[model samples]
Target: MQAQKFDLVSPEFKRNPFPVFSEMRSCGSIVQAKLPLIGRVWMATTYDAAVDMLRDHERFPQQAVRNGKKNVAGIKWWMPKALKVLTNNMLLQDEPDHRRLRGLVEQAFMQHSIEEFRPRIETIVDQFLDELELKFKQSGSVDLIEHFARPFPLAIICELMGLPDEDRPMFSRWAQGITNSGSIFSFLSMIPKLWKMNGYFTQQFKKCRVNPVPGLLSSLVSAEQDGHQLSEDELLAMAFLLLFAGHETTVHSLSGSVWTLLQHADQLEALQANWSNIDLAIEELLRFLTPVQMTKPRIAAMDMEFHGQPIQQGDYIIALLAAANCDPEKFDRPEVLNLLRDPNPHLAFGSGIHVCLGLKLARAEMAIALEKLFSRFPKLHLAVPEKELQWKKMLGLRSLLKLPVKLA
Candidate 1:
């Protein structure tokens, strides 16, 4: 298969990509495709193929080769001191290193598990919804992304990290700066932002050292100090990763899910009528609109034949989770949204070792937020036309710039 160039950032594809994905999936599982800024790569577009590629970590490693010729199709940023720290995060790690870092993070969560988070998350949801009501009352409308989706998890993550709620806006700015590295020019543009973000994290780490708080950041700092395979660089990376990873996708997913349900009124009504089906609704939402659309690019470990295609060592491969989630072979009605979808084995959180570290927490936030949102505003709806909604071109994620809604 020739490397078919599919400009990922093109507005045409970004607007409504299911048709494109359907076309790609119809061709085969692992299609030779090229992203706008990421050059050529094997795109796994089917459910079985995506799962196989993701699960077979040994054959398709997560780490890019140390000295591989990384052709930046988009923008490339200089790996400054701070970014190098961020690069050492678990998302980009393989094998023992991944295990160790993930173990530490797991240990932290074990001490403060998901069940413990529900009450607090629920309380936070109520407050945010109340605030949303106030915003609607004051302004007659609200951008859900800015007013609700974004703030809900930002506040939760801040509380988890023992960071100040007041600093959430700052965190969101840094996160947007970091994750919006979609183009070469945009990637180059975020250097100063990265530096600034790292400096702020450094200050926060120092604060944690002085008077530690009962949060994940303090625990990670202590782990680093105790010499638990957690370097200062990794520590900073983990801290940033937690804040960045914890909320970015969830915010987008929540916003997108709301927008999606509103578009499909029957699904919204069905879910609202039967609260027991929320888990199914969340599953369908994750699958139908997989927010973290694709898994990070994986490099082939060595020469191998995959589904009759030759993969050379160090070649990059991308698993299209969004496409897989919508595969006709796996989903009965791949294009439609069914809140009561059963046996939903979606790969929205990915698979194998590198699956999302905070899947449970993400589910909790989605479930709580959606229930409260729908129940509170039974007559809630989109303020603007659906055609006007703008999606950010973050390579591996589906994010909306804004989602205006009226809670009347």
Candidate 2:
């Protein structure tokens, strides 16, 4: 008999998707099913198939119509009337445009550029830790998610974009308003919030146009090579993408990583023993945490067979990165948290030309933050029991709602 079809928005599936994914993976590497909100979508579980689908830009096009549609019912009405204004983004564009946009933005992410920001990042981490210490002293307990995880990434990204320090709080609100992944209404509510952000950025862009600095936004504004200049809409779209994508994922990763570490004290101790091994620990943590659980929906550009299952042209495929990362075939003792595990090929940042552009910056922030956090608060332990920790449910992103830790 055939197995039941999987539904992405079903209450049971939303509460815990791993069991459904496990059943599907057991049947085959690839599975076809209908989602609740989304009509028909292919689900890929195995590492090989996931990588194949991600790497093949020809067979799986990223420029599907669904890319621009924000999955919110009223987003169309709320956003600018000109569809071109919203759709001309790197995330929604195909090559040549994608390549051109990425090339211009790549300069800000070069190795030397990232290294230059290390000192500033370290300072930011220190400030957060200092505040955490103060709170621990005052109240004897603190929520790490609010005090540290959320603010660290927001401050860093805001500074990178050349936004003033006073504007950091507004940036945080705008980001949450735009990226909240609950109901479609939650996403729709962000339209007004994003409009505010857009207006703020427009003013900033104009300021840079007159007196530009060497920041990411300014660089993009001034970027011109061989008479190729990014269009005004493209610049706005890139700004939205960078601000939303750059900070939110890293915030989730940090929160999830800390929660995972506290749960697995032995692994945390092992990393504390040799700080040099933190890099490997970060990779393993990233693999285990899998912050971004669902892959962006990709449409099959042509008729193809995904692991022998026929997929028609223009079909939406949702690759489960979290499940693939934990596949036993890909890693030994997939559930075990081994900080020293080598050859980790996890797709936490994703796989392909459209892979995360801020990956390096994310890693740098995580590494520095972990080093400072663990070093300063070696006796740091969760204030509440593991089971009492609250995990965000019915959301695409896997993250802890609150992580209360006490600094010794």
TM-scores, in order shown?
A: 0.95, 0.92
Q: After superposition, how far is residue 2 of candidate 2 from its true place, in Å?
A: 8.4
Instruction: Give RMSD to native, each candidate.
Output: 2.0, 3.0
Give the least accurate 10-residue stretch of model 1, judged by summed lDDT: 67-76
Model 2 C-alpha lDDT per residue in residues 282-310, reported as the tens digit of each score: 89988887888877777777776778888
What TM value does model 2 have? 0.92
Steric clash pairs (candidate 1): 37-73, 37-74, 74-184, 75-183, 75-184
Clash-forming residue pairs, model 2: none
Per-residue lDDT tens digits of candidate 1, residues 1-408? 688866555556666779889888777888888776666789899999999999998888776754153522223245655476765689888887888889888877676787988999999999999999999999999998888998899999889888987888888887777777777777778778778878888998899889998888888777642366566788888987898899888998899899889889987887888999899889999998898888878888888899768888878888899999999899998888888889999999999899999999999999999999999999999888888888887777777889999999
Tell me the whole-model lDDT of each prediction, alpha carbons only: 0.84, 0.78
* Residue 242 lDDT in candidate 1: 91
Clashes of 1: 5
Q: Which stretches of model 1 miss by more than 4 angstroms?
A: 66-77, 224-229
